[model samples]
Target: MRVEDGFQPVPFQEDNPYTSDPVLPSLLKRTLPSSAFQEINPDLERLGADVVTTIRPLGSSSRVYPPRLTQYDQWGRRVDDLETSEGWRDLKAYGQKEGLPGIFYERKYNEHSRSYGFAKMLLMVGDVHVVFCPLSMTDGTARVIELMGSAEMKEKILPRLISRDPDVAFTSGQWMTERPGGSDVSQTETVATPTGVNNAFGPQYTLNGFKWFSSATDSHVSVALARTGSPKAGSRGLSLFLVPLRLPLLRSPSDPVPPATSNNIFVHRLKNKIGTQIVPTAELSLEGSEAYLIGNLNEGVKSISPVLNITRVWSAVGSVGGLRRCLAIATAYAKVRSINGGTRLLQDSPLHVSQLAAINVLYRALTHLTFGAVRLLGKSECGVADADELRRLRMLTPIVKAFAAEKACAGMEEAMTALGGAGYMEENGFGRIIRDSLVEKIWEGTTTVLALDLARASQDPAVLNAFLSWVKNVVSSCPSDLHERLQKPLNVVNDAVSELASSLKKPIAPLVPRPALILAGYVTSSTYLLEHVIWSHTTGEDERETDVEVLRRWILEGGMVPATEDVRRATQDTDARVKADSTMIFGRSSRAKL
Candidate 1:
């Protein structure tokens, strides 16, 4: 009568996130040279094999303890310290040693560096717990310093930020949000008053205000946006600053009193969230904190833009990682789990296989899109991008960020459901996958905001024209058979471009058009897949038939007619009562009446 004696299911445990992913390796082999593969293959394989020992403890127990804030000493002396978890700290060394950031900074593979770095990093995304959180900002921080910081600033900070030695390396925090603004930095209330200081660190600014959301609060340095001129000047009057959490030790004992260890940064509280609990996100107060000006004052928004572009790409990559993980779990679970009162295997179920394959098609399409962004990022950074490539990269960043994020949340949810009731359990990791992926949709920029950005960017004739030309080149080369399959989607995308061009002449109503933006993402992502499929076929060194099957299946899954399918889905919401009730939550005042 014991529970152990009864029927029990075989668990999908001890699988490596890196090794089990058949898709990433295939994509790498087809897109990159064998030498490129040789460089990354060892790292990927090592991460795959040793994953359980290295990252499992970090993942399974990471959220069990959230970060704690310590404000003072027992003697009542002010000593603000943010105490994080062991899992958070222990994974740092391994992450740094893996050289995820180093590869890009060093450009070991020349133009292929960023793609190589991202491909390696993407594989580690699901396994690293939320350590990738700080790493994203840290990578962005290093890039900002490299691009804009003064010679002294870059000399002093960039190496540490990209260092492989844990003792010398540093993670970074990005503090832009305040009480009044989220994505709207024009509403910033933080002020940076120049102290007329011309010291070694440049013009010293006494920052006084609150940063409402500060992820990686325990990091050694940060990039913050603060107002330098008239408050009414809005985002244009803002400036970017490099604030070291702990200043360099006062070169000599004779130097003016050294700044405190915390740089006057006080941790208010950590955000208690449903997921990504491994990353320490805190509310911070920056009062009289020392900071150095970076780039031209009042052009802060424009300067920090590069950082945004970098982080958005990271968010997109992370989103793909989460989706890939969920798919892995679903596929892995099916192979082992029995269904129908243990009479049949879940893998053999036609309904179950169809459900997974359908989502997998979407997943594959998005994978290509996300990696395409990564590849272009490498090309552009290496100065190999032409004018058209630059414009295409600009357009693709937002599309991938918005599409991958939104789709990941939805895709992971379906993946969980495919696992049956077991998916809902905290132990299985699906719950974490669903919750973590939700944040990507909001961070960097919400879907609506990004879609709006896309709408705005499309106003440039070059952006649209550049994208269409690239699409035509790829679609035109698709070997006729594949070209036949691509024609409908290509035609729809061409019409979208034409319509967008017309809309540019007369702006679209109430801007922020969500549907059109989403369709852009779908069209662009599918094109990326088609381009990649064509490349794989041309290479002759990779699996051509499998690539063809994947491309064929993705198109069959309704990827081409994104707008039509979206409209259909929207029209299917026929329940007026449910629709009305759904709005009640957002309509706080109306909810009371309901």
Candidate 2:
């Protein structure tokens, strides 16, 4: 039977890590008490069962390194074949049956294919990172969600995707960033001119401008944001287009084949990067690429927000997984490796214990935050009452993206430190984890960019007040005993909000500078507040009684307030001090030279 026949897309489980036992899930449940934890328990258990049933245990010396090469090669060759029509069907059939190919396949392909790396290659070829674009492409997990939602699109693509049958993967490259734009959709410059369907051109758009970094250099399909109405239309003037990568075929092909003629899209060059070397980043020139609009003209950003929201959350999960892997490696090493006295490092040192404990706590908090977001997405998908949940998801996506990415880097760094000198070695995988974790900050969106976005969103009294009220409700609803544990940190957040509201009550100038600082403060304050609230809900105990009770106490005692003040003062003081020091040093040097 064809693999496609066996293909059954697994519904996304918020907490299903591919593993062979219920150990991880049981641990998570023991550690966390969020509603998401309860919701994800069944799925986690199912996934654990699936792992045991499917994967054969390789004996005790089976190396995690040099993963099964033939399987990896087969997957890569299949994807390569899909670049053409005849091969796409066969490959799609395999993918459909097996579900999304894991990172092992991705690593294998990058090693074998010297010409292009994962998502990045698409950018080099001027195709948006769709399926073919390894660097920028959303993984199979996300693609499955998108396919599930659109039966029409699914019907057209699933057969090919599942059968390993070749058909063009119509993954959309998101080209919304600009030179001065920091994830601000309103600041985009690419212009899309709608050309009414003509006998010659057919239904098309003439894209005129540059996109700094585009994914999937070979992807024939892209959803570009362009100015359609007014230059100042900001996001309102922006429109989305579903543009084909190639010119219209004179006639439809007898088989599923990408068109022969190239559209005007061209890759200027690929970006050099620190890690994720398998994925390519491309500079793109859209010198009259033929495109068609998707959704209403003015509602492009709105339509894309949901996609971005979902993808951002997925990215957070990926980062979490990476961090978990880092911690697991570090923990294992700590227990086994000997130190100064021929004792295991973990046993010999209090500092090591503290680091491990801190990492564990962070892992718990971040895992809960990420899983909670995933649960929110699942609940929204399953038609749970989530209007407010959706908004909360929106607010949290940037936070999760920013916070998790930052924490993942920090966590991995700590893991590296825990390993001492050995962590720096590339063979240990800590280096790779560090390199990979760097992208988490810049991926989806940067912290500073998201901070500004949050700040802007906060300016809208409605969004701001609603969010504040929602947080207030969450705080108020906590168990009475938990209130004592939460009250101090909660009060700090409340005070910050009140101060911000007072500042915004009147018109203010230099909006960019001060607002930026305020936004940072807001993210820090809100993140802690949300963390405390979620912890309160999930732990099912008063905050004072839980394991993170110390953390909560730390935040309340002086952690939250001092952190806020330090951020504010540091932002203002650091630059001026640096400039003054530089000036004084240079002047003294010149005088000495004279």
Report RMSD (Å) for each prediction in the order shown: 4.4, 11.8
How do the residues 1-594 of candidate 1 rate in per-residue lDDT, one tens digit apiece?
998998877877647766777577777766677897887777777777766676666655633457777777899876666677777776766778777577789988877777777776676676666787788888988888888888877787788789888767888888998889899999899899998996575677878889999888778788999999888899988999988777662233355534334477777778898888767788888888889898888889988887899899989888888888788889988888887888888899998999988778777888888888888888888898899999988888888999888777788888989987888998888777677878998998998898778777777888878887887777777887766755765566566555444443324544325665676676677677777778777677466666667666665454546564543343344355444665765665554454
lDDT of 2 by residue, 1-594 (tens): 987795342221212233421123433444344554565456445533432233212111121111111111444431111122222223222222323323212322222111111111111111111122232233332343243323443444323222322233333456766665747768777888777753231335788877887654444455567878787788898876655556552223364554322576655555566754334346667788777555566777875665566557656655665666567667767666665656454646887877866676566556555655555555554456356666655556676767677666787788788877877877566776577567767866777676655555656666556556665676566667666766776677666555544543323222332343333334443444455545546656444244345446434542346545544443455545555666687865554343
Write down the TM-score of every candidate: 0.90, 0.66
Question: After aligning candidate 2 to the native by TM-score, how far in Å is the CA of 532 from where it should be?
Answer: 9.0
- What lDDT does the true structure give each of the candidates? 0.77, 0.51
Error of 1 at 193 (Å): 1.6
Clashes of each: 0, 43
Residue pairs of candidate 1 with colliding backbone atoms: none
Candidate 1 runs further than 4 Å off? 62-64, 249-262, 340-343, 485-505, 539-543, 559-594
Error of 1 at 61 (Å): 1.2
